[model samples]
Structure formats: structure tokens, C-alpha cells
Target: MYDQLVNLISTLGFPIAVSIYSLVSLSTKLDELIKSVQEVKEDISAVIKYQKEK
Candidate 1:
């Protein structure tokens, strides 16, 4: 019974750890993507304003 419990826990722990790591990585990538898109939007707005001034 003890060995079965240990085996069960070990098996579950690895997948759980991997899933958490994947989620964190995905979240970081999405945040970076959002920041990059926002930067591009701001740059475009500046160009449009500059053209209008000219």
C-alpha cells in the first residue's frame, strides 16, 4: 500500500509540475506579445500624426 501510494504521488507530481511550467511560459509569451503589439500601435499613431502635421 505504501509503495503504491508513493508511486502514484510521483507519477502525478511530474505531470503537475510540467503543466504549471507550461502555463507560466505561455502567460509570459502572451504578455510579451501584447506589449509588442501596443508598441507598434503607438508607433503607427506617431507616424499618422507626423503626416498630418506635414
Candidate 2:
């Protein structure tokens, strides 16, 4: 019984740890992507405004 408990914890622990790590990493990457997209949007808006001035 003790051995089975240990095995179950070990089996479950690794995937949980990996999932947490992946979520954190993806969250950081998603923030960066959102910032980049916002910057691109601002640049496009600037270009459009400049063309409209002509």
C-alpha cells in the first residue's frame, strides 16, 4: 500500500509540475505577443493617419 501511494504521487507530481511550468511560460510569451501586436496596431494607425493628411 505504501509503495502504491508513492508510485501514484510520483506519477502525478511530474505532470503537475510540468503543467505549471508550461502555463507560466506561455503566459509570459502571451504577454509579449500582446505587446508586440499592440505596437504594430499603433504603427498601422499612424500610417493610415499620415496618408489621410495627404
Candidate 3:
């Protein structure tokens, strides 16, 4: 019974911890991607404006 409990704890606990870490890392990366996209949008807008002026 003790060994069974220990095994269960290790199996469930490690995966839960890893899942939480991965989610946090993914969220941070997604935020960075969004920021990069916004910057690209601004650059495109500037290019369009310059072309219109020309």
C-alpha cells in the first residue's frame, strides 16, 4: 500500500508540475509573438503611408 501511494504520487505530481511549467512558458512565448506581430503591423502601415505619399 505504501509503495502504491508513493508511485501514484510521483506519477501524478510530476506531470502536473511539468504541465503547469509548460503552460506558463507557452503563455510567455505567445505574448512575445503577439508583440512581434503588432510591430510588424506598424511597419506595414508605415510602408503603406510612405507609398501613398509618393
Candidate 4:
């Protein structure tokens, strides 16, 4: 019974750890994407201003 419990815990722990890691990585990637989009918006605004000046 003790061995079985240990095996079960080991199996479950790996997937739980993987899930937590995946969520953290996904959150970081989403933050990067948002920052990139904000940069693009700024670039577009600059282009619009330049066109208006011309």
C-alpha cells in the first residue's frame, strides 16, 4: 500500500508541476505579446503624424 501510494504521488506530481510551468510560461509570453502590440501602436501613430505633417 505504501509503495502504491508513493507511485501514485510521483505520477501526479510530474503532471502538476508541468501544468504550473506551462501556465507561467504562457503568462510570460502573453505579456511579451502585449508589449509588442503596444510598440506597434506607437509606430503606427508616429507614421500617421508624419503623414499629416506632409
Better candidate by TM-score, 2 or 4:
2
Give the per-residue lDDT digits (tens) of candidate 1, residues 1-54.
Answer: 668646755878867756866898999999999999999999999999999999
At residue 42, candidate 3 shows an lDDT of 100
RMSD of 1: 6.7
TM value for model 4: 0.68
Per-residue C-alpha lDDT of model 3 across residues 2-48, encoded as one tens digit per residue: 68656756878967756766898999999999999999999999999
lDDT of 4 by residue, 1-54 (tens): 668646755878867756866898899999999999999999999999999999
**TM-score for all predictions?**
0.66, 0.77, 0.74, 0.68
Q: List where candidate 4 sits over 4 angstroms from the true fold.
A: 1-12
The C-alpha local distance difference test score for the whole of candidate 4 amounts to: 0.85
TM-score between candidate 2 and the true structure: 0.77
Q: Candidate 3 at residue 12, lDDT?
A: 83
**TM-score of the candidate numbered 1?**
0.66
On a 0 to 100 scale, what is the lDDT of residue 33 in model 3?
100
Total clashing pairs for each candidate: 0, 0, 0, 0
| Cα distance off (Å), candidate 4, residue 32 | 1.0
**Candidate 2 Cα errors over 4 Å, as ranges:** 1-12
Q: Candidate 1: deviation at residue 38, Å?
A: 0.7
Error of 2 at 42 (Å): 0.2
lDDT of 2 at 54: 100
Score each candidate by Cα lDDT: 0.85, 0.85, 0.85, 0.85
